[model samples]
Target chain A: MDKTINQKAWFLVLPVFAVVAFSAILPLMTVVNYSMQDTFGNNQFFWNGVGWFKELLDPSTDLGGRFLASLGRNLLFSAIILAIEVPLGIVVALSMPREGWTVAVCLVILALPLLIPWNVVGTIWQIFGRPDIGLLGYTLNTLGIDYNYVSNEFDAWATVIVMDVWHWTSLVALLCYAGLKSIPDAYYQAAQIDGASRWAVFKAIQLPKMNRVLLIAVLLRFMDSFMIYTEPFVVTGGGPGNSTTFVSIELVKIALGQFDLGKAAALSLVYNLIILIVCWVFYTVMTNAGVERPAKKGGA
Target chain B: MARIDLVDLAHSYGGNAAPPESFALKPVTMTWRQGGAYALLGPSGCGKTTLLNLISGIVTPSRGKILFDGADITPLSTQKRNIAQVFQFPVIYDTMTVGQNLAFPLKNRGVPKAEVDARVKQIADLLDLTPYLGRKATRLTADAKQKISLGRGLVRSDVAAVLFDEPLTVIDPELKWQLRSKLKALHRELDLTMIYVTHDQTEALTFADTVVVMHDGRVVQSGTPAELFDKPAHTFVGYFIGSPGMNIVPAAVSGHEARVDGHTIGLHRNYGVLPAGTKIEIGVRPEFLHVAAPASGLLSAMIERIDDLGRARFARVRVGDEKFSARMPPGFSVPDNMVGLVFDPAHVHVYADSRLVEGVA
Candidate 1:
């Protein structure tokens, strides 16, 4: 049986093509244009011919130096958040009540931090970390520890990390919870009948079942943490000596603060490329470790 | 293998002490002999799963004791009970290889590595899963996955008994018979006491030596397939066991005869006085009902339709307002408008309130 090749199916796909072009492809083209050219007022431009990319990539250059530093900070922040939040989220997901109104209450409370606007989270943490009157800082100072987020680099870094973890760990926990709930009751019953220990059950059954969502949690937390700007910008203002300036804050400092559009656009492209490469790497490794990926629709 | 005895065991899904109607499993006191294959045959929601869970210690009985080989195991967990259960859907460790999946139970019990490998290899070969020993369990087809689950049960030598909760449900139709026969062979080879739960009569009759028929939380009847087909203890059994099961007709009973719609009919043996408040009905299999010319048989009936079923022709005959199916021999001419049903008196079974009444010889 041969399928008749009707070429008209492309018409059905035309709308999606148009939407992607106007919303994404066109704006991306503008970024590419800005990345490769230098403009000096009055809409006049000169071809920089990859000069921006070259400048951005060279750590010796001022633009490249700033970008590399922020990139390192972004990588470090992502690593720390992923390491802290993933395990903590899984623990929280495991301890979560399985049923009843308490489940609803816990879920609502867990979701409250996620629902708060990012900048408000920053504002709240800024006021809460003041050693003068705020409870946390005041308590720490009264204990004679000399805690001050405003003047200490380490305190600023700690405050930003804590704020980020407080704002986002619930998302990971919730994803992991959904994954846990998807495991059928039969698996646990079978494990018990097989006389498997609790650790064995977690290792063989629960963890394997949670792998997909953990992948999601890791990827989302990685990408989001790497791009964090608003909260840290509000609290530490990239802080006590530019200690907490992640790549996004640096990009904004170049693009809007100093109005270096060419350099910023070039940095933005590199940042996006890094994210795409890292996500691709993570996706490949996680999927391969899962034995075989679930077959995609219409896929073999 | 161990002989399992349920001593007045009962289960109710309700959180509180439930009334009789709410009980998922009525108090059942029966023993499944060691080295015998038994089937719990019932419709969906007929408490077959509940019974299987109780046996596997997945669900503790609401009341009474479960004894395995004379030791009370009612207070034990499924782990301590040393039971193996294959769920309705195949439960395999997706992350493990076939050999690893088979070795899971043995390893979990702290069996030595060499013995675990030997057991896994032996069971995998027995189940024809040797070719897939190194392959991941998740990549297998449904039937293969099911075989792996069964292998998990077989890998352990210290298991008290093996319970299957319709393990063949996910298998393909063509592969189901193959898997079922393989399971039966495994049972005999291992000499394991196995209990299979299924609603399909063919699955039950073909796989099990004794089929325990359940209905609405009660064991309506438990017997060999031959006994269930030849003599159903209850009306539900008569209506449930055989393909196109026994035909039951409401009748009024006297000492030596039964009357259907006021027509007097003869019985094989006299049933002594039926008790008051008894609901009388006559059960006779279609195989025993003879079709004859109109007015020459027990009760004249109008022929509704005849279905040709390869070897047998099933004729629908209407007696009074009720329809009954009769198995007709090949070349027996079925009348277009009228026929008579001659029920073999030797096959006549009289039911009083859904229970079979003994014939007084």
Candidate 2:
């Protein structure tokens, strides 16, 4: 068969390329340019190739020290929140009403947190956790536990973690619920007929059915938590000696707070690269999990 | 293996206070012999799956008792029933390998590891799944997955019975034949009491020693395939069992004779008295009724069309206001629109109110 080569296809792709250049590529290129150069006041610029990157990576340098500290805190925050949310989400999803008007009511309650704006969630928790006038802080203080998010590092961390959990766990629960709902009734019946216990059914049937959605939930949660800035900034303002300042917050402090655009741009590039790498790994794992191996030779 | 019996078993999804018309399964009192292969044959919504679920203890009957080997098991949970059931779609553990999927039932009941392995191996071999034992079950084709479902059902030797609810519905048409025959061979080799539920007549007839035909929510007829074909006990069975189904047309049946469209047709037996005000109908299978030249037979018919079905030819004919299907001879061509239908008197059956009426010889 003779195949026709259609060069017109390239012309059709020009508009899409133009859109990407304007929306994504141009801004990213500007950041890349700033990352590699130095600029002083009044739009003064000078070539300083790799200088900002070098300072950003070396721990002895001020920029590197802040970047590494915030990166570590971000990683720890992500780990803790994931540890608390995933299983809790699964439990909530499992307990969701299977039918009736109650299902709608439960779903609405679960979604209440996610529907709230991120800054608004931070503001609510900020007032709600105040020792002077807030319900949670006043109750905790009355119970004889020392609690003050404003001045205590431990309290700030605890308040921020709890706030993130309250705001985001519903997303994970909703995803897992969709996965659970896709499972056919036959699996549960078959499991019962097989004399399987409740735990066995969860392990064998429910868990396997929810694998794909769980992976997506984990990936989304990880990325969102790693890049968290607005909520904690409003609640803690990276207080108690920079304890709650995540990588994104630290980058913003350098770029906007200190007016060190070159250093901030360098930090932004590295942070974006890390997210891209992790996302790539997750995508590869998900796609690989779905691929079937070719059948072995000499088999019926 | 155990003989499973249902004593007045019935179910209504609407609960105990619901009226009889709301019953999903009408009361059924029947005993399934040990090691016998029985097929519940019916169209959709005919209570086949409901009955299967009742036997498997998936759905509790609203009334009556179920016994396994003379022990009441109606109140028992599905886990306590000791019966295996395959659903319409294959229910397999996606994370498990084929070997593990087959071994799951045995493993759950705390069977010895070595025995579990042996039983899994045996079932895999029987289903020609030996080659895929190490492969993940989720990666297999639909038919292979269905085989895995069947394997899980058959893994335990002491199960009272195995119930299949249209297990081959997801299989490809060509593969359906192979899988069906495989199930038949497994039934014979294992000597297990198997109750297969299907709407397809071919699957039921070819796989079962006895076929129980159901209609509405009731078992209308239960007999061997040959008996169901030769003497259908109910009009539903007569209409449901055949290829073109039996040619059923309204008629006036009297002693040794039936009148259709003011023409008399002979009957082999005497239906002395039919119930008053009941709709009387005579049924004869297409195989027993042949198309003949005009005025050559007892009743005249107008030939509407001739359908050549590769294996045989059947003529769609109309007599008065009723339509019928009759077999056409290989060399016979329509001489005219008007023709005669020759019915074998022995194959003629009389039905009153859709219930077959046995006649005296």
Candidate 3:
């Protein structure tokens, strides 16, 4: 067979390459350059060769201690939020109205929080948690509770977690709802014919069908909660003795507040790498879960 | 197995107060005896599915009661009805193995594990699904998944009746015959009451002992395939059943003859007089109506086309403004456009207002 390869196709891709270079590659290259070198203001620089990464990973040095502490906090926050959100999202999806006008109303209400800007969400919760004036705080205090997000570490964490859940749980619920909706009515009817209890139906039919969407919900909720910044920063300012100081806040403190560009750049690279690896793992596991062969034998 | 009966059962998606014209299933009263193989056959939107769902309890009839072997089960839930229904599309649990899928219904009913295993094995073997028992059901072919659905329905030995709602729609054409024969064998071996629903007449006629014909939301006729073929009770049945179907043309019926386009065709039975002011027509299957050389006595027709269907030949003929299909006798070539139609008096049925009219013998 005579085959001719087209060389002109390369030119067709040049526009996309140019766009990506300016939008992503160029900024990322600059970060990589900064991460590899030490700078002493006024554009002065020197190569340090993985020194910042080593320190950031270590727990003894000041940068290392702060980075590790905030990383731990970020991991914990991601864990807590995912544990709460995934099941809560599925429950919300299951309880959603199946038909009629109420379905549209419920969908719009579910989407309300997602439409709010990130900073707006942060600001709303910031004021909402003020013990003296905010509804939540005032109500809690009136119920004989010592709830002050501004002063208590536990309260700060609680307020941030609740705020994040309020802001993002809707995304998970909507995805799960979409998955649930895609299930045909035949499945429910079949389950009914099989004499399956409600729980059996959920376990055997609903959960398996929702698997793909729940994976997405977990991945999004995990990444979002891990890199949480504005909400906690606005609500507690990562205060109450660095209780809710997630890694993004720490990175910002190093890069912009302290103007330690090298450290911030190194932290940024590590953070990006972590997210990429975690996302890769999630995608691999989830997509595999969809078509995996747990039993590969005895079939022709 | 239990005998099922639908007593004055009806359903209207628009609610009970809706007009009669809006009912998805017009009031139907029938009995499906135990261990009987029945097929509800009709075109799309003919309420065969509505009837099947009503029996399965997936749909609650808008009015009237359903009984299982004389016990009223109208108010019972689907689970309480102990009926199994396979849907139009395969509805297997994706997470389960083929064996697990087959075992699901039994497990749900808290049947003994050993019995569940044995029953699942029997059903799986019956379906030729033994090799895939440990394989995930979702990984199988469309037909295999459908087999799993069927197996799930059959694994429960004591179901009131196994309902199939066009279960073979997704199966490959080649596999359809294989699966259909397998179902016939299972029906015999299990002695379970199976109600198959489909729009295809061949599937209904071959798979069912009694094919129930539905039209415009009403059960038009329910009889053996031979009965439906030999004597169609309604005009729709006459038109819907046979391959070429029954030929129906408007005519004026009086005494022992039906006049078609000013030509008289003799009838075996004497319909002394049909109701006055009512439209009259005659229905004859192409099998009985033969095409012959043009003659003065026989009803004259203009032959438009002749279709050789391999096994038999048929001529499409026009009598005045009406068209018909008539059997072409063996080796009887068409002689120009003019032809004579010979209608067997024994098979000729007169219709009044699109319904069969009984004549005095």
| Highest TM-score model number | 3
Which residue pairs in candidate 1 have backbone atoms (N, alpha carbon, C) closer than 3 angstroms, thus clashing? Answer: none
- DockQ of all models, two decimals each: 0.38, 0.42, 0.57
Best-performing candidate as measured by DockQ: 3
Q: Which 10-residue window of candidate 2 chain B scores lowest in summed lDDT?
A: B291-300
Worst 10 residues of 2 chain A by lDDT: A291-300
- Cα displacement (angstroms), candidate 1, residue A22, comes to 5.4
Residue-by-residue lDDT tens digits, candidate 2, B97-147: 788888889988999988888888888899999988878788788888998
Error of 1 at A7 (Å): 9.9
Candidate 3: residue A45 lDDT (0-100):
96
lDDT of 3 by residue, B235-260 (tens): 99999999898999889888999988
Question: How good is the docking of model 2, by CAPRI class?
Answer: acceptable
Q: lDDT, candidate 2, residue A209? A: 84
Q: Where does model 3 sit among the CAPRI classes?
A: medium
Candidate 1 lDDT for residue B161: 84
lDDT tens string, model 1, A1-300?
999998999999999999999999999999999998887657887788899999988999999999999999889989988999999999999899888989999999999999999999989999999999778899999999989998998898888989888999999999999999999999999999889999999898989999999999999999899889899999988878878888999999989998777888899999999999999999999988976543332100
DockQ agreement of candidate 3 with the native complex: 0.57
The prediction achieving the highest lDDT against the true structure is 2
Give the per-residue lDDT digits (tens) of candidate 2, residues A186-217.
89999999999999999999988898998999
lDDT of 3 at B94: 86
